[model samples]
Target: MNKNIVLKAENINKYFRVPTLFHVLKDISFEIEKGEFVSIMGKSGCGKSTLLYILSTMDTDYNGALFLDGEDLSHKSADQLAFIRNQHIGFIFQFHYLLQEFTVLENVMLPAKKLGIKSLEEIEHDAIEKLRLLGIADQAKKLSMRISGGQKQRVAIARALINKPSIIMGDEPTGNLDSKNSEIVFSILKELSEEEKLSLLVVTHDIDFAKKTNRIIEMEDGRIIS
Candidate 1:
């Protein structure tokens, strides 16, 4: 494995037991290098999301191996996978999934707290710093519910970065935002991948967004088409 490769999937295959064991993925293999911004694009039910899940180490019932930063994670236990996900993989979803009742800062600090490597004050400081990096520091003290959709998404990004994971995996990260907001989110993600040397693996249906990434992995009928 290359030292720069943050994620690699080999000969991956998945099937649904229902409906007579329909296949959902076919010999998927790909690598995402450190600091690279990559996008996975396909229509609905094309298995892009399923592939993302496997890469994120959230789906363990696949037929192939997965490696993350030189570690073979294909057969890790559930507890081990949970720890790996929290410590190494960051996730951003189509919905921001912010805790509406919590302040933006608190929401961002949640993961760090769960990781329990830092004091509350240290976590708060880091959370504020992440928010500042996202240009949303001013909203830190505000309740998550009080912010606009775009601001909420930014908060989610801050939360994702709190652990400083090696890879950030996003499933339709900009799917719910307007064009203006989508562009804003996209730019932020790109900057993080470039300036911060963060790796990003995103699944999106937006061709425009996919086109702007460093590489676009296209899928069709559960197989890589390009």
Candidate 2:
């Protein structure tokens, strides 16, 4: 499905100014086909995270066009970008970012609620199924702060999939875990990408994990090196 182009980054460029100046992305471009698991590997300052942020719409001031299903993303306003993110993209980060105060079930439900998805029972049902798939359903009602790091990461994965996103982007998702746990997390991500036909883009410094992805992209000095 490479020809389908589920996502496209056309000559993308991003610059950060003030305090100091930096060209974070240098005419970078890439695409993720539907159901592909792609990994971006780079040194810490090579802009892999920055690229993911821009692609995920977490940062929108870049200089090129991003298309989702062939729709120009640069034309959208901040509110519209937020709405699109809510509707089609789910983000997972190294830090799990679960609200420590919220229960696992609550954390997963927050995004759906924010998007005004109706039928609370139905949403809960879906969320519960995700948690079950990730092996955390038994802890769904427990506070996130009380879970183990691996368990917390599982919660984060479940949260990311709760919306059934068309694309899920993760940055160093397994960076904080031990080898055993990292493999667990990657397997879950791999399962979801295949089982749900979701395009997954992950950035990682772990070469072993990166190599396991369907496509391994190497970056250096803000450019794709391989």
Q: What is the TM-score of each candidate against the true structure?
A: 0.98, 0.95
* Clashing pairs for predicted structure model 1, backbone only: none
lDDT (10s digit) by residue, model 2, range 89-184: 888889999999999999998888888876888889988999999988999989999999999999888888877787889988998999999999
Total backbone collisions, model 2: 0
lDDT of each: 0.94, 0.88
- What digit string (tens of lDDT, one per residue) describes model 1 on residues 98-208? 999999999999999999889999999999999999999999889999999999989999999999999999999999999999999999999999999999999998999
What's model 1's lDDT at 109? 98
Instruction: Return the top candidate by TM-score.
Output: 1
